[model samples]
Target: MPEAGIEPDVVTYNTLIDGCVLTDDSAGAVALFNEMRGRGIAPSAVSYTTLMKAFASSGQPKLAHKVFDEMEKDPRVAVDRAAWNMLVEAYCRLGLLEAAKKVVDEGEGRAAGRGDGKYKRMYVELHSRMFTSRHASQARQDRRRERKRAAEAFKFWLGLPNSYYATDWRLQHDGNLT
Candidate 1:
């Protein structure tokens, strides 16, 4: 669109990002998102959530969570239920029940339960599909490991790159690990 002298806005980026998801092109979605930001077109909640959807659909919960965290930190847009739900869905896609549950619990608890039972149905469905303690144990370990890594990321002397902490920290510290 820019080739035609048409300035792409947030909506344009969101639509293209969502298209990338439909095509299972998550890297393309990320590229478009970064390009959007690089061009100074501030991302809306829809832009963030759409990019998160691309990551979630591509089974990249880590990237989805990163987009979600950026959305929350963005002064231009408010983090709404759709953004929260996309994050929950990302964990669900990975069969990470504990992570999804944590996000679901937080979402449901927000605003004194305004969106009360929405996640209950989805969680029940996803849990029924698992029907084993195996996934539970694995998810528990993953959650713990994620938290420990996030906490330890504060050690600047370790010299981990910025990309490491920026993306990984969002999935930790849900009132359980400070």
Candidate 2:
């Protein structure tokens, strides 16, 4: 990275870290993280999330806790459900039922009650649903319009001269033919 003239930013670091984790290369992830810190690049929520996932998947809960602790110290760090879900699954896989339960409870608490948090979730959900519905309605209207246009085109085609069938007769039973 230092060799390249391109300076490493948070986005670049995050991508490198994600690739390391996907390949189960925890050591590489750690090295890149240290390099990031040395370069004075503050990790964002996405950075922490990727590190947390790497640590958890690599069976290195100790390192995961280190990242989590750092996250807690950084007041601006926003831990999303994906982060919590990673811990929850990790704990469950390790048969740490209590820890898994605690993580789950904490996530639920963050999204709990009929207060502002709940209202915010509700607003997000409602807004997304309404937006989806509007898109679907527009699609339906478009289909209807297309069908109408096709019907109109067929009518015009039928109305053209010499467009009729020469014989419009039904078959008769037995020897009788129409």
Q: Which stretches of candidate 2 lie over 4 Å from their true place?
A: 1-4, 110-178
- Candidate maximizing TM-score: 1
In the range 100-178, model 2's lDDT, one tens digit per residue, is 7676666666667424365346445543433233446777767655554444443332232231235344557765423
Cα TM-score per model: 0.61, 0.58
Cα-based lDDT at residue 114, candidate 1 = 64
Worst 10 contiguous positions by lDDT, candidate 2: 156-165
Off by over 4 Å in 1: 113-178
Predictions in order: lDDT: 0.76, 0.70
Q: List the residue pairs that clash in candidate 2.
A: none
lDDT tens per residue, model 1, 45-117: 8988999999999898998999888887888899997898799889988899778878866766774466556
Task: Count backbone overlaps in model 2.
Answer: 0
How well does candidate 1 score on lDDT at residue 78?
96
